[model samples]
Target: MADEAQQGQLVNDRYRLVRALGSGGMGRVWKAHDVQLDTHVAVKELLLPSGFSAPDRADLLERALREARSAARLRAHPNVVTVHDVTLVGGVPWIVMELVSGSTLQERLRVEHRLPVEEVAEVASALLRALGAAHAEGIVHRDVKPANVMLTEDGRILLADFGIALNEADDGLTGTGVVIGSMPYLSPERARGEKGGAPSDLFSLGTTLYEAVEGVSPFKRETKVGSQYAVAHASVPPPRHAGRLEPLIKGLMERDPDARLTVAGALELLAPAKPAPPPPVSPPPAFSPPAPEPPEPEPRPASAPGIRAAAAAPSESRPSTTRPAPARAASAGARIRAGGRTRRVPAPPPRRPLRGLVLFAAGAVLIAGGSYAAYQWTRTQYFVGVNDGHVAVFRGINQELGGTPLWEVETDHPEIELRYLPVYQRKQVEATITADGPDDARARAAQLALQASACAKNAGENGEDSVLTEEERLLTDRCGN
Candidate 1:
């Protein structure tokens, strides 16, 4: 009942074809769902041309099945498309591959023109690793073209379309070595009707990189035949956009397959292009504080308790003098006045020696009195604690052992048992027991005893055990009497 199935044309009772993803000369790809896995997958159905006989359809069918096997063999590779299932429906072979969500390298080229050198290096690096994996498994990806390379939405570059590639034991490739891939990516040896090897795959990789950086295939020509000719005879044009990657590109598409860049060499060349570590962020600038206003001149001591600052410096009351400074200095030095000789007045008597002594003495006496009062109050305070299963009373809030016990009492009564009370309640009872009046302390103890006795009777009526200590249970049970 799924809307994705093509009018009851579903396959294997598992995959339901949804829509056409793409189509090539060999097969048409569909976005399909695997009912068993509950996930999306790509289904490729091989199609025979209209004029082809039944035998041609059969041959292509076998080829598609073989391509599925090839893709399945490299399942562990991250850059290689995963082959999930291969099955036949209605006498047609359908290959299920991973549903990669992204645009083809060729499509990206149409938009981006040419990739940046760093980006191309990364793409090439991924492509080389995929090829290396396939080559290691004795498989050759005969066709490595822009359309066969996929740039994923997550920034991963993948190699696709290994249909024409064959395994090591497949002797079919040795027969005349007719080029099976696109012309631009075909090496010279394969174009000249010779065999292609691992090196030939590298040449295709170089051509792929060259196009990625140059925005055009290395051996593109007007027609397929011209392209084949150029693959064998034309020179790979110098890449202006390749920059640091130009050498690797040229090395990979070398005319002689033996001279081309091997997978290892290609990896070496792209090593520097690995994305560099991100730059460290810097902390924000700190604010410079405003300078403090100059301290106000200490006010002149006006009363008995006030403290005065240093000697009153150069009073503002001095007569304003501009041109008279020299005359004043000469008169002071000669001990002479304008009309009669006179003795110079001595500098105002050195400021009173004990200016702030009285204030400091008063402050010391007040501090001594406050400290003594605090000491006496601390020694007068009392506290209660448990020691050796009995109530221990101590003097002073700090409970230091500078003195003997101030008071000790039996803690066997439920009302007085410190252990039966929560920490805060126990502290309150200790304060009440040590109240200022002995009569008040006794009254509080009697009130607490009556409350505990009532709680004990309630526990018995409810058929619940009391939480009080065993000694407290005896005291509470006798309290009502």
Candidate 2:
């Protein structure tokens, strides 16, 4: 069959093979054109050994049909690949499915070594949704691995290849004492030849996500048998690069299937934590002046010749108490009478100069000068950093003064996403790339923009369509598709 399968060959006179997309031990997949639908599709060709017994051939054929049915059952699921039809040509079953332009997760890991923690979280969330949908239909995707997950060109994560999926509606087709799953991703129960359930699938997903962010399989050994043993009994090594995803991965990879994390639990762990709102600001209080103290009477001069002091007035007739003052008494110089002689006392010393007013004026001048100098210094300083997730140039230092930021965004490159930049460049942006002036800072930001564009382009070439905003789309367009 492998020799006979070639480009231009029509399957059941409907799907015309265009090219080989990929091949594995079980079968080969091809990019094909559907004449009836007038659309492009993927056709998977199941290949059996030429020397199979009659019963073995029939069993394999049944399994292929079961795979088609399982995928078709979840066709409405966005995260699961859609199965179109199944046809037989030359006694071989060919599965026709929707054509998705993308590469497998395994292929991506081969080039990137590992993905960022946030990106891995996104993948895990999508896969968890897909698994939840399948589990709802009483289906367990026995084979969940990096190679079976697809990252489409349209920023979609899809689970593919339901060849070994188990459906509760159908009688179990797997024979006893047979373990049918990748060794590294197989759950302990499955590795020990037990009939595993949804938990087993979860374990495989955990392994896949672990490898996605850590660049190494947790329990993978040197050989298949050794790896199987490790899966059955080995302790999962701690991940050094998983960041916040470490807990979720560890929970999913638990040795006890019953203790393993569920889809709901994993979703909870993946949910982004909402930031707390800033405390409310209160307005300042109004001001009021203090009350004035009453003036004290001046003491009488001792032994003054026949002079009567103002305090010597009779208590009962002390200016009629609260009555209006007499015109003569209101005068600045009031006379005192004693022994029929009239005398005058010097007027109170001129009010002291307002020392506080002079000090206040001096302080105002100093503050104004200091503010002008600070403003001038800020104009001369510039640095490159991130502003709301975009690369930007700032006019002052990244520090803060009295709870207020010292820097202001001078030029923001909205098209350049800070997260997409390479690790080294991201670190530089986070630490604030200093510059001699605004122009120099802008140049540095432009360099970071180019790096971001290059990174986005590489991701597209590798079939990883990262979600982007309108501004980010402009950057992607600059990368020429």
Candidate 3:
């Protein structure tokens, strides 16, 4: 990586770079100042890695420049990321545009896991509006994912990353068998090596929105092979949230493109009218003001021309108006009569016992304790107690020595020793006795006393390494711990 100051100096005379924003496979984007306009803009410089041949470099530059110009046409819409100009500095292609202050939708999704249904609807509506604008202009955004959507701090949504966008007028630039775009968000038709359309972009948007609402995309799998299979035929599951809009999310995430709602159609489905709040019970007091007296009638002229003028004049008669009259208030004796018949508020019902939780916990504890006891009993076969602090196995022994189990008889103190003793006879190993008690010092004293009454016998068999093989190690890794 180069220093920020040094990288900014690489801009042409017309544009002064500020800082490098980020870089991708084909280009690096920088925040720069357009010296001619004195405004901040993002300059995307196309760079073909050394791996590409000269011919490939020329093709990439031309394709990138053409796409940038096509994206510039979408600047008329507010939701679409604006592209300003395309230029070349030292024969390398570059694009200048408005700088957006926000994190990518990908970053948001990674942190949030999934959004609520209403939130999903809001974001999807914004995205669809942007897409509708582009599709109207015959521009198809080949790649649509959370990474390409910019979410501003103030909550405005902007569709970005038009690097792979295709203009309806331009000839095909992508080579055959080369599938572009992110695999998880790719439409089924695109995954099958077909040219993507507005519907294809909508499908990608559906997948992105599905993940935003469901915590996982419908077509996601642990392996690329599995993902590919899922894209071919699998339908994504509905969002886990039980809000009012779960069905709408399901509609958007349908497997068949035809079954999915169109962008305009989805906008309507997502934008719901909020319920109006109830009106207050108390009414404002009514006031009575004296009405103005009727205006005095004007005198009429006594002539034929005056008679015609009087006929054409507006009505002089005062309009009759009616006002709502105040009703009479009840007397104190009438109010006292009505108060005696008021109904009493009922008391709450008695609380019920939660038997379900108590039974479930009891069952769970029994299963866990039984499993632990069975595990402990199986481990006692190989080793026998030599003393309070040690165990007597065969002549040889091996242990991974992960950790020692704590003694539960007294307190759960690790210092307390527990053991199993093997009683030996002439040239034979006999029964084993288990003991777990208090302080380690006391246990050791008891072990020494027991040892005095016992006699040493022939050693048992030797032990060998049981470390897992390489194949088993790989299998465990794949299965997940």
Candidate 4:
């Protein structure tokens, strides 16, 4: 069967193989042309080893057919890759599917090392939607991993390779006590040989997302058995680069299936906030004029003693004459008539001091203390940033004190040049990638070292003449590539 699969070979007298897209242990994927549909399609050819017994061969064929049926059921979903048709040639299943034009998440990770948190969330949300559709049909994608996730060139995330999916309508193919999934991403229940359902798929999705942001699988170990054990027993290492995605990843990766977040709960966490309802606009304040000052009392005219002697003698007998009080009292100086003369009232003296000096001294002390506290807080924060042209770790906030940066370089990786990084990652490093602590910052730098090495390898492969410096050669050696 392997020898029969060659370039330009016609399958079922319709689809023609153009090129081999990729291959795995069980099968190979080809970019083929569908004659009737007049379009390019990906064909999965199941290639069983000659050493396999009849039962193993039957199991492999059944799994391939199931993969086609599972994907065909969710053809309407935008996130799930559409399966076109399934046919058997020479007694082996050849599954035809839509040709997604882009790299896998695994390939992208190999180049970029890790993605930004927001981008990881976007990828996770798309995969969740796909899983939601699959779960609706009682199908579980048991083999979810970075390699099975397709990031199309046209801004779409598609989940592919449902070869190991569990369909409720179909009878179980694998024997009891046999686990069928990637070791690092296998759910604890599945690791314990349990028939996992929706929760198991969610756990794999969580592990994939975790790797996307952290550049390493949480449960992956040195060996397959060790990783399987870690998946079932080890606690998830805390994510330092996941920022806002930490809670969602943690919830989805919960060890207990019952305690893990449901599809609805995960979606709710990813949904954007409702813009806070625009803050409830308040009406403009009404206008009210201040009260006018009361008018001053009018001066009285003096009367001639001889012309109005009776009136003058009676008013003078009381020793003084007084005018009738006005309705509103004068707020300013008041005039008084005494001894037949008018005089203005004197103003009151200023009030005594209220310990203003003491209060001002206390305020100055508070301001100084606050400034010191802020400086101390900056010392605790750490970030991964670019120092000159290389990756470096800094201890302090990714901010500036006046015009000078508040951060200081804690460690410098001169071997990892910034120009070797992808443009997006270069921007992130320039802006700074926040870390939980000094150790986390160093770990982030180590990841960047790997990214730089990959970039250098790519450059060399593409004949770009990007000669690596002595330090860069040492970096590549350290990365074991």
TM-score of each: 0.52, 0.60, 0.52, 0.65
User: Whose TM-score is higher: candidate 2's or candidate 4's?
Assistant: 4
After superposing candidate 4 on the true structure, give the runs of residues whose Cα lies further than 4 Å from its correct spot. Answer: 1-5, 35-39, 47-53, 169-173, 275-298, 302-481
- Tens-digit lDDT track for model 1 on 1-481? 2234463356789888877666765567888888898998888776543555566556655765676687788878889877777788887778888988666788556433555677788888888999999988788777788888987766678888776666544432332333456777888887887777788888888888888777788789899899999999988779888889888887887787777888998889767767888999999999999785444343344564333333335556876666654534342223434343354444434455585888889899999999778777766554344444333444444333357433444233433344443233344344433422233234344444444444454346325554566545433422222
| Candidate 2 regions with alpha-carbon error over 4 angstroms | 1-5, 48-57, 169-173, 176-178, 277-481
Number of the candidate with higher lDDT, 1 or 4: 4
Candidate 2 — which pairs collide?
A: none
On the 0 to 100 scale, the lDDT of residue 446 in model 2 is 64
The models' CA-based lDDT, in order, is 0.66, 0.77, 0.60, 0.79
Pick the TM-score winner.
4
Which pairs clash inside model 3? 385-420
Runs of candidate 3 exceeding 4 Å displacement: 2-6, 47-61, 90-92, 168-173, 221-226, 242-245, 273-481
RMSD of each: 31.7, 12.8, 28.9, 8.7
As a whole number from 0 to 100, the lDDT of residue 463 in candidate 1 is: 51
Tens digits of per-residue lDDT, candidate 2, 1-481, equal 5535488988899999987777765578888999998999988887653556677677767776775676688898999989888777777778888887666788556434566687799999999999999898788888799988988767789998776566644332243333556788888888887768888889999999999887788878889899989999888878888889988999999888789999999999889888999889888887778575345466556675444564565666445547676655324556677675656666666665799788999999999999889967876888888888888888888888789888898888888897777554565567777665666566666656655766676577425555555555433422321
Q: Cα deviation of 297 in candidate 2 (Å)? A: 7.2
Candidate 3 Cα deviation (angstroms), residue 274: 8.6
Worst 10 residues of 2 by lDDT: 472-481
Better of 2 and 4 by lDDT: 4
Compute the lDDT of residue 88 as modeled in candidate 2: 74
TM-score of 4: 0.65
Supply the TM-score for candidate 2: 0.60
